[model samples]
Target: MSRRIRVPFVLLLLVVAAVAPVGGAAATGSSDAGTVDVAGTADLDGTADADVTPDTAAGIATNHGGTIVRTTTFSLTPGEPGSVDATMRFDLPDGVPELTVGPFPDGVTVVDEGGFDREGDRYVRRDHGRAALTLRFDLPSEQLSTADVGIDTGDWAYVRVPYVPTEWSYYGDAPAFRGDAAVDGEGAVQGEWAYLGATETTTRSAGDLTVRYVRAAGDPDAPSPDAVFAGWNWLATRLGSGGRDRVTVFALPTPDAMEWRRSPGLASDEDGAAYVFSRAPATGTEPAWFHEFVHLLQGPEPSEGMEWYPEASATYYARLAALNLGASEYGTFREASTVEEPRNVRFTRRSSWRSPTDYRQGALALGAIDATVGAASDGDRRLADAHRRLRDDDRLTYDSFRDAAVAAGNGSAGAEADRVVDAPARHEFVDDGLAYADHAPDRDLDGDGLDLATEREHGTNPFLADTDGDGLDDPAELDRGSDPLAATRDADGNDDGEGSADEPDPKTVDSDGDGLSDVRERELGTDRKRADTDHDGLADGEEVEGVTDPLDPDTDGDDLGDGEERESGTDPLAEDTDGDGLPDGHEVHVGTDPADPDTDGDGVPDGEQHREESESDGEDVPTWSPRGVGEMVGDLVEDALELPRMVADVVRLLT
Candidate 1:
């Protein structure tokens, strides 16, 4: 019985190149246009059944296994034509598996493939995996030159196999294989071909996958070739030289064709070719591009038991790349994944596996590893070095990866790796690592009390303490319920229903209408909304302009208000003006000039004369006239006697 296993969704979109068979060199001949021809065939049908074991039969038996033969010919001589021919033979030697073939290039004309139903760009052979057929097509030289393939039709072709490689364009695992070759009539020399072992072979996984691009003609919806190249270039630079050098990216016309859940659902070739199903531009901004590109930088997992590492690393780097390229902000990627998932499940445990949750948690684990490595090495090494070690090592396994990490960061990295890998779920250590990767520390770049990450999220300028140029800093603005992103307007512009008539907007100009702007109030350390900040009966603006302390009601401590002192032309900071003994306010209230000690020019001082009169009369008299007190008293008595007689005369007249 054929037992076909469902392919992993991510792997279906990946097309990895075949590692050359043991002792075989990769194809390395250059044509005038740098083009070469490649041909291969895989007979997955039961006719070539070698093993019915659980491992080999799972992919072939359950799924409708079929045979696929393909040939591609192109020139390296810049501006040359190329061609691709594929034959799909189907049958269910045991029973019909749902056999389908060829998401063939767009504009391909079918020639002599009998009894096959055409469905879009693909050829369908149903009710059996048993059949033989051939397909033929032509490729233009200009189309071949660009990095994008299938641009005309918005889809590319792929042959379904039991297991697909993560890289693009490699067909090494095809059941019965024919080597790569040059076209029959082309002047190109036949390139070398090798049948690398199946995906189960961990011994010979060192070599990189070869990539090629194909696209549909005149497809306006396709991403620009330049953008695709730039994105790849950025990814390559990030991964460093040890990463895969050659990759082919096929830009699909629509997103539907690239859906993971659909039929003919392969998004990548066994070789390092990718099928991008986005209608948006293929710039680095697209997270999907980064996600797939990261796969090329990943080395093979150490063992079947450790298969999650590759996927986890890919997931982690996708977000990292986006952040590095400024396509996304810090914490965005982690928030989406780690925030919702359970924190206590072992990532490697089968029962703990959840679609995106597991993926995100695994990424966190990798991030922790990266941080540990970086920290231990004092930034002298990084996670990339560990990956490079994995690529260079002959054995790929969890232990190998751990050893590499430990070596990269000395002994410290090993403990960190264990802490992440063995934990049931995420921990604070993981969060710290993720934060470290994001450069989230105690950094308040603007000294606004908000960290750089928060500043970025709130749209506040990290370099400027006051993002809006408001009188308040960003933190103060937040505390005051003001927008750090918007500048504080003048009083006339403030109508957001926050401040009342009595309390003007502190951020506005002349907030208190005291002739001082909010900026000036801040400079003078006065309340912006209160005309008399210190309740000294003087406007803050006037006090500030007059060089008096707005915060102090009694600037001179002379029993005089700042406003009264200013009105009297007395120094507000000094209690005595013009050597007067009386207080400034007291002198002004008594109708005496505070600036002059003796207004009448008497020999005695004004304060001394007043004191002597009070002592002599035994009364609290503020001032005494120059005439004698006896004359004053006589005038007072005469006025009183006259008032009584006048009253008696009025009473007699009334009677």
Candidate 2:
């Protein structure tokens, strides 16, 4: 029902709101008095007093020259059976500012509300709207909001404060989304991110960089926050700098209901913060955690044509970071280079970019530019420096990238950049201070099954190694026809098996389990989402297992599907299993055994048994001519007279 996700993650709608300031400056430490206590505050009745000194920790906290606001708190409680009771509280310091709200997500409606009227798709706020307005919305497990990651499974609730549309809640001259979003009992929401139970927290740090990991307690098979922190550490070290001193990682267990292909994970690059949706383990998108970390160090969206740059850098550097951390191999990296896009596709036309289809293209091109810049500076300058320069550049474009490269002392990179920005052409790419060498193209350096020849075919770096801590190496995976990149899943749905994925089909881990990816099905002219490409009563996996053509309804051209032929005791390849004149399909249609020559038990073969009737083996009887019928009748009468005469002669002889 949903489209396949080419890139590993979805860069969700980046919230662009006008500056609705709630607090003045940043503060350190926590104050219990103002700690956003929404669940149990019988003293304050229903309203959260805004005049009280803002809880600098949860509401609006200032730190490291940045602002973290939590002026808007959305409290969620377990509801009746498969439902969740949710309430939104906005701390409007200047009273309820002129605002219009409503038309909440499906399955969410307010009861006993009298001040608002519906107009088209929105609820018009009336004059009598109170300061402590409590809009009770029911979030059922069966139905979910469009942009919100709110879930209620009758047992626990994971709620990511829904990003309401600007028009849906038009706050005229009022600070609508002024402060940060926090759960009542869960404390401050990270990047308006996941909140489950009470938001238990932990920390992992390297040097000056610290990653705060959060998740619900007792979540099943939650992803290891330590592993994600390790990924961030590697990327930070490789880049020689971390974007910010501290960031948050909400590690929610991957919900069985959550579809990774539709929406995998998200990151707020401005805050150096991202969340790992796989607190529970998953596959399809290999190294999703690391990729999110890379995004933390990136800047906002660039201008047109260069819009692809942010994604390209993230995709490219993330894989490389995984390799640096011993998570991936050179063969895996090289294989991505081999991925081909349309010839007309170029980095300069990034405005027309699509996920994953163009990501690999830009990645390879960016790699070439990085190599060029690295070579020009004789290892003194690298793309990392240029990247740091661009992180703060408000206006990001190709020219700015060139200027950044020049300032980094790789002036020669502009020429190579020209080649990549336009079209991908052959260019000298330096890796580790030397041009990529294919002295032994057939050599499998790491014995991971992939050879140097395959690596260099993409015209990019062949220097790669599987560093990810999985037992199966890249060479072995490729040699065995298993997925060489991304997390591999075993038959038990665990993440430690050799994969046969078609680039991690976005729908599910081999949704059809047909060993083919969804996109590959499209390219092969098969049903993109159906496991049975030809719908011959056989699954694509079954077809593969039985050594039949999954793409053909009738592999043997017998007008019977391979599955049907098997059921009908006929040979799919022979057109007929038995040595009969009738085809298997025709014999079945005529109710005769295709395996038997004489299906009617006559002295003649089934095919020749009805020879006088018709030339075809159809369900029809031959019609006798009128003269032939009369001749038959006369012979029958003469035989009857002779029988009586013979009987009388026999009786006289016996007497």
Candidate 3:
């Protein structure tokens, strides 16, 4: 299979050769006289022609050739996609001209070839051929390129991209993005910021957003003067609700400065007290301002028993939005998997796994929940739909959100949630093996009196029927082309009774759908559902994940996906192979020499013997590192001492 998309958007190759300056080579035809027509004539037809002028108001125009010019610029807008529109005008100088435009680039789509709308000053040229050769075209939004824009004269032409961004427009309003703040008049009003809860605390509204900044009323250093104004701009941007939602930021500079000094009674921080202000902004590290603004819109965490789903859902939304907008570096949310966990010393005492694992798994569970619900609703009740229902229709409690999701999926308010039943089992893998056992809920799958729940209690794996009493699960056998009920057979058709089937075991499924199997994912130090093991938010399974061939790294020969090695700071091929603090290539870059442990000036390497020499006088021996090695050595020494031949030699020497 080809690794890259067959219809690649861009292609560039280097050729070692000398060529004459453009237009110096030939002039087989003139603009006034007839010329052969080809697709791309904009960038490479002539020497600097006279200034052609644009008849219309939208694009720039040059006068000499009288050719109308247009350009395209890509933006960080979603849903509106991307597109290019241009109208070319060539004023034929009373000459019979057979003008040809040729050699269009790959993937350059022509949406409309003729005139579209005719407005007052700049309207469509219905019949440009009669006056001049005017060609109007619309480029595909998803794929934009100049490869198609080549120059073609009657007999000769040149190659270069000529389209420029003279006038750009989107189908719908563009949403706010990171750079939106940089736009003029988009910043805070009145050089000074309003302080929350301080004397300057006030309510203001702009565009569909309401802004409120509250500092502690009694505190002297309640709110900074600048934060309040920035907050207003943030609110306005979010409420605009077009391309990307903006937010009003709330900044608490110190631990004691927040309005709410105490942790309120709530389930998770995602669903914690939203109405109250915090001494510090909520979790998230980059661009410090946006994270807190999202929390402000979160309002207060839903009252106990009320719906708190929005808190977590909104946080998820902000995180995804930030990623899409390029506001935060990739992998910013890797460690936020378990949302509601508290920050106590004991909370960190779980088995030796990292925090990002939990966050990724937890987030994936939420995504799966959304998917399950969306599937049930035939696409009507989406994740956003569920959120709306929770706040508007239901009372907004844990039970309420759960019921809404279940109802949306089953198309009934009281329909039994068989899917929900599997969640507890699934949670065990994600939540560090801490969950209830599997319990198939009572659900009528077949019209017969028997239920799936009853079958689970008595039947074997549903996909695999393994009735013959073989140890392998039927699904496992079918995966390996062996009969599940029959004696286990290896690839050679031998009844080996060893190793499970060639297929992976199903128990260790990934929580995220990133494609890394759970067991291998864990062994390889990665999220099972996510191929990108580093929680950098990219998938290693996809060629895009910084691994060229997610399946076969050796195939690319680069030893890394151009993306993975360039971005995530991990070796694309090896995992901790060098035993350096950094991954292999990184160590190589820092000159620490990945293969050598003692790259430093120090004499000792990093293993047990070196460690022993470096420890303090009273330090205990590192038993965990040396136990097995020491015991095996002691046994060998004792055996050597007891050798009868050696003992006899010693006795003779003494006599």
Candidate number with greatest TM-score = 2
lDDT of 1 at 265: 13
Q: Please write out the lDDT profile of model 3 over residues 1-655, one tens digit for every residue.
A: 0000011111111221323121111112222111111221122223222222223345443222233232221112122322222233332221112233322234344333333343332323322232211232222322112233322211111112232111111111111101000101111211011111122344555335554444333434444535434433443343232222232222322323222333211111111111223333322322223333434333223433232233334344444434323333233433444344432211111221234433333334445455444434433454434443553431334555566666556532212222222222132112210011112235332222434344333222222234224555444454565433335445445452455334333433444556554444445443333355332334654543344444333332333334545464444556444453344544444334445655453544433323454643433223243545776786587467657754775674333
RMSD of each: 32.9, 26.8, 29.7
Deviation in angstroms for 17 in model 1?
Answer: 40
Q: List residue ranges in candidate 1 displaced over 4 A.
A: 1-85, 88-215, 238-245, 255-269, 280-286, 427-655
- Candidate 3 residues lying further than 4 Å off, grouped into runs, are 1-208, 214-311, 338-364, 371-381, 397-423, 426-655
How many backbone clashes are present in model 3? 60
lDDT of 1: 0.48
lDDT of each residue in 1-655, candidate 2, tens digit only:
0111111111111222333244332111111121111111111111222222323346643221111122335555554434444444433223232334445556455543344555665554433233222444445554333344455655455554433322111111212233344556654455444464655677877435677777667666556666666666756655534446777766655556666544455665543455556532322224666666666666534665686676677777776655544466555555545554334355665323456644566776777677666555544566766777876666578888878776765555775576667654432222321122323567654444556566433221334445233455555545554444435565555544444332322334343456666445534544333577555778876776676788677788766778888797777787766766767776766567877876655556666654544434453323334556786886577567657755875674333
Estimate every model's Cα lDDT from 0 to 1: 0.48, 0.51, 0.33
State the number of backbone clashes in model 2: 26
Query: Ranking by TM-score, best first?
Result: 2, 1, 3
Global fold similarity of model 1 (TM-score): 0.41
Preferred candidate (lDDT higher): 1 or 2: 2
Model 1 residue 483 CA deviation in Å? 22
Q: Provide TM-scores for the models.
A: 0.41, 0.50, 0.25
lDDT computed for candidate 2: 0.51
